[model samples]
Target chain A: MTGIFFDAVTLSFGKRKIFDNVTLKFDCRKIFGVTGANGSGKSTLLKLAGKILHPDSGTVNFPDNAQIAALSPEMKIYDALTAVENLKFFARLRGKILSDEKIFELGRRTGLDMKTFGNERTENFSTGMRQRLKFAILLAVDADIWLLDEPTANLDDTGRENFFAEIQAAKSEKIILLATNDVAEAQICDEIIRLPM
Target chain B: MKLFGSRCDCVLAIVRKDFLLNLRRRATFAAMMMFALTTVASLSLSTGGAILDEKFLAAILWVVIFFAATAGLSGTFDDEAQAGTLSTLKLYGDAQAILFGKMFVSMLSLLALTIFILPIFCVLFDVNVEKIFLLLATILFGLIGLAAAGTLTAALTTSAKIKGGLFAILLFPVTLPIFLPAIRLTEISFTSAQVDSSLLVVIGAFDTILILASSILYDYL
Candidate 1:
């Protein structure tokens, strides 16, 4: 799909121009970090790339019928599901049955434990834990593009490390686009693009 | 190589996911079941005498279906909208398939609920429900139309703060055209056991139009 390319992509909501003729490209299978001020459009850029919202102008080159794995800020993990249950739900969406062995492997990769919390419903898991679980689903799905928005928003130091590790392992061949407010998060990125809020 | 669209596999996947959600989430299914049962019981008990009048009986049946439709839609989209799965869904399949898929399950549930409670309705009202085949057909056609119309309106206004209320309001006017014949055909067949070919034609025509329009407008919705 041209390795995640944007040609003069511009998005304007009302009088404010969220993005203006912003043209950029990233090679496929690279970890890219997108950083911006409070309203500079880091998240908007991700949504545009994810095809959730169209740019007001210009075309975004993307794989046709790409199987996407996204961790949006607005994502709400089923409070009633354990980390395993949540992963299985997304896995099935891609037409893959969730095997027990596969789910265990995902939990391990994302630093989630099923022994104590796997059997339990996710309703009790902390917000940071929910964040970790969502990223875990992204890893399990193994989609062509990974659009992560603030994946480490609520995570503690260890969770942050695990989040990056999961993204790195998952990006061996998949395109990874991360939008974050954390500068440390950008350090691991192959390319960093700063957007205005 | 069908990348997207309402193929059997895609629809089945959505239906399977929905049915699984219904089974896993006790509160949602329990709430729908209890509401269906209670509404049926109260109508049967409170209106037994009044329903002896054919017009009143027909009206009550429509009301029951209406409320049942509402109860079903409320829980059906809850998973996608409330679960924040809407964004993920956008990337997986054609929006039309997802729309029809959700509508199919809701309509299926409506059919099951209608059948489950119809016997009790027949006994409670003590009306000779004439033209049994036609009556069943009407429910099938009527609910499919309802599901299509409701599916479009629900997606259009799902972002609203009062989605259920907004959905009812948005649908009420759009579907007014169907009400007269739905009632007329039901009343005609039930009262006289005379099958009105014209009435079924009207309902069938309405069904086709509504389903087609809803399907076409879903991309916009």
Candidate 2:
């Protein structure tokens, strides 16, 4: 009951049904993997969990006060700002004002180099570096639920390993709904929901 | 040191972000200012040393403002859409904060134009106002209406296929009532004619109604 439940949820675009009479329960204190092919409503499922999109019919039930932090490749980064500035901006959006040391610590934990984290504008960052920055932001927030869509898409092996470590540490403390098609990523979850089943 | 500590603080944070972003981009603001200057210059050259009526010149000022605002203000939400930031902001802040933040930016942009371009307009057109205070008041009130209406319409049309065209089509008709009285009041200020207190009251009332309506309906956007 402390987790999210989607009861008889229906979503459609024009005549194409994305989710039809789908019932899903995403529990806290565990990582739930949603795996499918590219067009399998994986991101939509996460968006529904984050309350960014409403189901056409049926109910999405989460605790009224639950704080949901969502990370996706489509999520925005202020490219004009430095990595530290981007973290500060996102922290303020989450209503938390972090000290410089704490921010640097988070960057370090997420595998970001201290020098690049402090000095580089994200516009010049490589794809793997940007993914690390996004993970750093996700790690900084204290939320009840974390919804991640294709979080490892742009990362190299080292970055993926760092991500898995951070996410594994937080699995018991937060509800993590991961949308991915990677077999290795899905294997780490306690349960996997393969869409279009 | 921080601007997003409370709900009101969030509004200011959004405004500050938008102001800085626009300053960095500069294309939209520069395009609008250039258009305004070109319009004013063309009008001046065509008039050819003739003394245009004060009412006509005042009307010209509003016309330039109308076009410039329509040109630049429609893109307020376009940046949010492009950067995929709107969904994040919606999750983070209340609707009123987002709405007022955008409205504040629109108002500031228009007011900046009034401040920078109006003086040049007066000099170029060889017109001087007898009541500068009243003229300023009228311009401010009129811009409030434009900002309120412009923010709403921009939000509504952001996802439309023909974005700028749709924005103008939806915004211009709704803003004319404000423009008509604003032009009249400005003319009165320029000619030092009897101040029609009733007209000022009407413009103020329209502005209030626009802001209230936009605020109430913003959640839907």
Candidate 3:
């Protein structure tokens, strides 16, 4: 009933079945990679865990007191807000009032330029920069579980290296549920589950 | 428990973010103000420079508020969805808090619109409001009902393909009850008619029901 769990879960839409009687558990302090081809329900799996989707006949349970952060390309940053403002917004959502210096420091660690981050809205940032900025906020959250869907999509080499380094550091105390197709990314996970297409 | 505090923070965060976003764009505010002004002007000109009756003026005022509020507030969730921040807010905190926060923002926007339009309306129509305080109370209550029902309708139509059109269609029927009492109260305020306590009660009850329903329904949404 704690950490993250799927208990004989079934998910479907209309007559189409996505996951059939799937059971899995993701523990704390480990990286979990959900690898599958297109239409293989990797994202769906994470959605079930994140409580964004309900299973037809079973349950997905996460800790009651745990703080969760979900990151995806579809997860948007406010276009009118500066990067630091966005970070502060997310921090406030989690009930933490972070200082601007701390926010900028987190962005810097994620390879964002502090100058542009402080002045410019994220609407004008490059795709890599946006992804890095979002990831930086996720890191700053220090959540108990992070649901990341294709988190490295638009990251450049340096950004990817920084993310991998951050994940490596955080894996000792956080639970990371990652959904990606890249073998390199999958290789870093402590456990990997490849869903059937 | 700290739960209440956290939820309050979440609501304030949403309200602040939406106000700033709308302030920067000014699109909805401008649209509502323009629509209100245009409606008032057209109505003033249509009588061939003759004075219109208080009942007709009351009807026209409610119509303007309805259309302008619909235009301004229907995109509550749609804008968030387009900006890709709905998922973030949905994931981060309580959905009910988001609903209340959105309703609060809608109310604030409508209040601003009312403040900007009432003076222009009085001047253009050449009608001195006999009961200004009563009219203000009526408008305030009407706006609360509008915000509650409109915000709930916005949530319902968030996933619709024909968003704005569908939102308007769905909103009209749900808000009719509130509009009736509001228009009656406004008409009374414009003339020497006696005040009706029951109408005010009806509007207040409508607001309470709509807000409670929206709060409960948002979880399923």
Candidate 4:
């Protein structure tokens, strides 16, 4: 299934044109990377794809079952909630009730421990640990499209490797749109497209 | 979906989160409570000399609610705005959920603030409880309108912290038409004549319109 189809999409911030009539089609089940220098439309394009930004011209269509799961800083993965509770909260938003098996599977894939990171308020965790729990949240959602902004941001080398492993695991059957400033992140994706300013 | 399972359930959960967050943070809660308390107390002492009447006292009491609600409602989205969680919420599918949830929680707490101030208002103003129910009713109606308006304005002002404090500055003028009628209706409740049923009707109308406006502009905000 095809996920997002953007044709001749033009985006502008006030008088400045960020994306110029760009055409792209995203397959529903592949890992795609977006690479660009500073001031390029990398994040803007992802926002456009996620329906968070409207194109000045042209259209971006979603697949029949397209749903977006982005990393959020406020995921409640703390002393108040078990891993089941955390995943349950996010999954319930989309009417999907993830079982305990699925929660642990995603936790392990993202290198987050339900037994450790769970049952503790996310307030106590380090930034890197909280980010991992967010990754666990993204994986827990059975959405058709995944748009990740700065997925490897502020992570150590080990955290970066764990994130890559999680992406590899997630890439099997979902359209993955990875938006990052780091060009090295491009190597893991099947193909990379650089949006011109 | 069942009532507990629907997005409506999330509304109270979000309200609970805001209340809990306020409860846990002692300094902020203490300060806001003190602010609410002293305002009501001073008003009571000042008006305790005036005719010592319930009707006039009820009038003074609601003025306190207006300011308190404006102050407290602005804090609804403060955490998300400062932390850049607003962007994350925009990407999240349930903008409606987030909007209504925050409004529900913020407005509910503002109501709680009203609850806290009511007794003080009753005591200091020496208000007659029976006649002042209209004052109480108007406070609820007024907060809903204020919260809806403040929530939308807060969403627009999220990028700038300075404007958040000036919420009432924006809210009062736009909502000016509401105050006179609501206050007049409240004053009538003190009178023995036929009640102006339309005062609350107008507030209800205003509430519906504001809620609709907030929900519609939420995506763009």
**Top TM-score model:** 3
Model 4 clashing residue pairs (backbone):
A78-A120, A78-A121, A78-A122, A79-A119, A79-A120, A79-A121
Clashes of 3: 0
How many clashes in each structure? 4, 0, 0, 6
**Ordering by lDDT:** 3, 2, 1, 4
- lDDT per residue for candidate 2 within A39-121, as digits (tens), equals 88999999998888999999899988788787887777777667887776666666777797888798778788857556677
DockQ of each: 0.37, 0.51, 0.79, 0.32
The per-candidate TM-score of the B chain, in the order shown, comes to 0.88, 0.95, 0.96, 0.84
Alpha-carbon runs more than 4 Å astray in model 1: A156-158, B1-7, B24-51, B78-80, B91-94, B161-164
Q: 3 or 4: which has the higher lDDT?
A: 3
Interface RMSD values for all candidates: 3.2, 1.9, 1.1, 4.5
User: What would the per-residue lDDT of candidate 4 be over residues B79-197, giving only the tens digit for each residue?
Assistant: 55555545644444367877898887767677777777777766665555445677667777877887788788777666564774577777777565566667776666656656777
Q: Is candidate 2 or candidate 3 better by TM-score?
A: 3
RMSD of each: 3.0, 2.3, 1.5, 3.4
For TM-score, candidate 2 versus 4, the one ahead is 2
Give the clashing pairs for model 1. Answer: A39-A197, A40-A196, A40-A197, A81-A122
Cα TM-score per model: 0.87, 0.94, 0.96, 0.86
Model 3 has an lDDT value of 0.86
**DockQ score for model 2, please?**
0.51
